[model samples]
Target: MRGSLGRRELLKGTAGSVALGLTTGARGSVSAAPEAERRRAVVIGSGFGGSITASRLARAGVPVLVLERGIRWPTGPNAETFPHMFSPDRRASWLTPRPVLTGSPPTVWRPYTGVLERVRGVGMDILCGSGVGGGSLVYHGMTIQPSAEHFTRSMPAGLDYERFDRDYYRRVESVLRPNGIPDDLLHAPEYRAVKQFHDHVAREGMAPYRVPLPIDWDFARRELRGEMKPSYTTGDVLYGVNNGGKRTVDVTYLAEAEATGRVEVATLHLVRDIARDSSGRWVVRADHITTDGTVRERKRIVTDALFLGAGSAGTTRLLVKAREKELIPDLPEAVGSNWGNNGDRIFSWTPLGDSPGALQGGPACMGVRDWDNPDGPVTVVHGPVPFPVDLGTTSVIGFGIVRPRGEFRYDPHRDDAVLHWSRSYDAELTDRIRERIRNIVGGSLADHLTNITLDTSAFDTTTFHPLGGATIGEVCDAHGRVLGQRGLYITDGALIPGSTGACNPSMTIAALAERNMDEIVAREVGKVF
Candidate 1:
């Protein structure tokens, strides 16, 4: 879409700034500074993980450059293509098209139609982000941590949970600022359904905890005080909200990091390949996509460190391609193996009467953790919402559980990833849970919660949470250091060991990134670029 700069323009413009700190050799080739002074890290994908990592690195005084494949929004030259789907003032962006599915045991993939089809196989909907903030700009902000029991049980034996909690998890929470919604506010109709579901579980002698969220309560309190209107409560968040609820990485970490002046984020620069120079420095090849439908491949950047925080699918595909091309051999066997979608299942029902606060735009504030059983199938029920309007008549109440039946592997022939997953439990088990939800919703407001089913067909279309692949273990030594690769690291959902029982994944991912960085900073490994 953009034109590649010729050698003449490159010598005096953007490339000149990059070449300032380097030495020019034969044939216009540039070499980086010595190891002692070269202290920059290149982060790909500016979603939750990448954004947070970049911010921390920059704050640490290590110059960090973020290369995002998507166009930057609001201020970038290509911002016009980056549309806000949920904006009340403007129509939605047609970039993300819905899919069409048929039959039982459905095949989950992008549908073959609309603009989404053009980039479908390239990890489109399941892992697509073509703007400044990445998915954080478009995801529903529901952030929850897994229970201690869930984390300990799923983690590999060698990982020290005590060390992990002390080193990484705590720092992550501080930056994310996750908080639990108050019980009283949750008594509203929508959350009442959530509480009722918990009540039913309690009646059955099962213990369920309220879901923790990442919303800014102080801001919400102001909105409730009439000082500010509930901006997020007005609509769905998957398409981006103006000034609403939870603190996305863009509004939080990235914004603050940019103020430091040490960090620079270049959007629309899609990284194509990573190679190591003769001197052991890292070189990145990128393609700058422009709005005019032209593709220009120029600008090779060399840095000392690199962080692969490009989600599971995106990061895994890049690594697999690199391995096949012999760019980086000796990658751990755990590069792209363990993968899980957190056993996502949406159960919908139509409430007979109108429900107040049902259309509120907050991401699920509370959930019934009643089914978080280690010995059996664990389930969590989310509050009802007007978004994703079910059957065109009824509101939808959704729930997801962590299932272990998930794996990620690379398909070199297809140049893509094969995500194989299934319901961790039988239909009968899920059906019983659905019935329990229906009964609870029915009893809570004197309205019937009808049309219940356990459908996997939805995965063929959309997902709010996706996890695993490049999981933690001896292969990476817990802190996400791939055994042999010296300067390479992974800090994304790909490092999640397994499914987080009855929990949303954004908080967990962000938390884990903080932890990984703690290890990196502790070792002083990323200090020299």
Candidate 2:
């Protein structure tokens, strides 16, 4: 808000509401002008949550505006939208000179306020997406539905697990159209990481099975045949697949939503604030950022409803900041509490002496699961990994589950959503998970296998899946309707209370969003919340 061009005053409860009308400005810029209110909705952040919610609503004939803080990642042969994993460009990050990653020190670990961001918090560094497609741009394509038992453990009470599995999860999968790693591709040399792990685990008396991935295998086969530039073959999973094989949100929900012509996707529009106007409509303030990272225009949207689907960090931070700034009173005390790393950790495993091949694949596909162990409740899953720097050696990343939650605090001076977590936050739980990883390595690998290395040693503090804050039955009702606030809803990963068992959290996140939209649409059209 420091450089924003608008009235700084927010909607105080006692004060009358204020409206800013649209006006032509510098370089053909425009501002908000209150007009006849329509039954319009605004969904913030275009990840799985935002995409699904916006798409379904538009399908139901509701005019929707989707505000995404990140740029629209391009596709096709001429598209150079993403950065290389090895030589990461500054554009790979959000307004930073370099890619902000795990093990970042204090100077780089700044509390985030910009709605468009790639941020890290103390002991819990998070890598969230900042583009139209959200984290789908950077995440491993692995998707799994958590076991009903473990899913219930992390989930807040009153969520009917059986119904979700039977209806919601199935509904999401029907659209996602996930497929197991192809039989032919797994035999390829490029997929040595997966094949070797699968074989090794089976030898260890564990029945390792193929996991479902959100990638289009048909396109991958075309790449393997040298008909096009490689995406999966080149290990372009983390930074994004430039060749367009990945079935990201852009290719699915967003594309379908745009086809309806009733939805508008505003990319690079940083949603700065949300408050109520006098008439009880929602005010959405978005900073229109150009390619050069300059704020070109301050655009505000007046809508009948607003959905905070800006992932866990973005949504939590925005709501917390709104409360702290007094823009919204009665913002729940649980707004920033019960958040955690999802027991996510990254450590390496390499062959004892032999070259572990290129150690490059589609970033992730196969992971070792030991969920049946009586010693602990953790899953040490591996991914199709890489040597990032091309060190000629292999590095396999292990993601383990540990159930510890953290909270977000609003710092007015910095105008940041600060997360306070320590390495020792859940020592015992972390140890249990790590030891399981060690056991998997020790019991499975041979003498030549090198033990897992510490690398930054801060690996345990980072999380790709940051869950909670504005969670169910806490900051919001079980249906994601914010308590004490009407005409507002939440549909994103933040609705997840904590971990999603040993699986990647995206599938569960989307499933929950699907269920949220079903309820929201019914309530909006007729049924009450």
Candidate 3:
């Protein structure tokens, strides 16, 4: 069952606590302290990969500094930033107010293109969070490991996934503390809707699965106080979850990194470019935006170690910008190409008579994985809806399609990405998947059912799950080290050269970051200074 409090009410209830924790004396000391020693590694973009890198590096006794382009989003009354997507000014900015680009890359770039071609083109939303925690602040917090098939087929050679996953994936999961919904919550009426749909698929002989959420079990229990409120009931996570049900990097790795006193985060500071010095160290140029919106150019403290975790857009932009300026020459031909957003589509179903709750809240928890066949296109359902379950009045189910290798081109003329994605060649496969969904929903509800088809047109603008621009193998080597560049690394979604079949990208990104950092620590720690 849903909680007594409306979404707004839940925000009001949790706002005070988040504010007290996120914005207090925690960050004051860094701003007040004098310039510290130069044994530091400057990290660009504080999203999941960057945050995890900073934390792990700091724990290893390396002084780490994180530079973020967006302001430190506070979980205050203005936490209204969480639901800005449904706001009247939906088209005002490319992303939420906090500087996190939640929409997928292609969808976000579509308006700039002015041409919409569905066939032969794949549409993916590359959603990325900004601010101190990066995407962790806004992600659905679904922590999933990439399947073995992904590593064997998608990952580049020389990269051993067997060793990497065994050594580093667990560490990443431990830091994030992903949790599964209790059986009781899963059986709740809101969840039942999703389960019913899954059952229908199973009856039809499809492979369906449950979503693994990154919620801290104990913390969530305490917050609920024995009540039946869904964890996702308070804030709209697709924008940003201010009440902390989602375990963004700020609350996870970055927070722990800060406690060690070896890490510092500078929000609202955008990294423009990076260059290696004559001594082989790296110098990063950045633009720092003040609270009043003033932009000032600042040079980051020089370091021999640099990590770039600024999602696909930010990371690609920086690398491309740097290449254009000759900061690093002899760049690879594939530096800014082969990008893909998990081909995604949303489908909404209206259930019969007043369902227990609405669809306003609930982690994307159930899905079907029929996309694993090499002979056929793979498909996976993350989960079903739970709260705000009034199908006629308020509910919808969203499914993500993982599309492989669409082309990405950089347009220096427009200072934007020109992407061409198409699935026309796969029409038969696409139709088959669509039919599967139609049949399942039809079989489950019988008489009282209203189905809504959501093409790319339904949303005023589309959002993204992952975007890869400065992709791996093309832009950087196997270990995230950019080609023709020393002391620089790329460690975000941009490094994902292709899709991971049916899985969420966050845990995969985090695991890769951990693996990359381990390599850096083993080889470069003493050389940084």
lDDT of every predicted structure (CA atoms) = 0.53, 0.68, 0.55
Lowest lDDT 10-mer window, candidate 3?
Answer: 16-25
Give one digit per residue, the lDDT tens place, for model 2 in 1-529: 3312222443321111221101001122344432332347888989999999888888888888898866777776525667665555555566654446542322432221221244556656677777778888788767788777777777778888898899988987877787788789888877776777666566667766567777778776787788877667767556777777677887788889999998899886766667766677777766676654555666567777888988888888888777766666567888888787776666566645534466466656666666676754565555654454444344444444555468888765556677777776656665666665556545744532564444333544566788888888888888889998887999898887667766678998988888878888877743331
lDDT string, candidate 3, 1-529, tens digits: 1222222222122211111101111111112211312436888878888888888788788888888766555553223434343331322222223222324232221111000111112343344454677766656666666567655555555677777678777887677677666766555554555556556567767766666777744433443454433345422455554445566777678889899998888875645455554567676655455443344333345677788887765676556544544455446667656665544444455544534244533556566665465554444453333333244422333323344456555444433344555555234444555555665555445532554333332442343455566666777877788877777889888887545444566777878788888878787777743
What are the TM-scores, per candidate, against the unseen true structure? Answer: 0.73, 0.87, 0.76
Could you tell me the TM-score of candidate 3? 0.76
Question: What is the Å distance of residue 418 in model 1 from its true position?
Answer: 4.2
2 or 3, greater by lDDT:
2
Cα RMSD, each candidate? 8.6, 5.4, 11.6
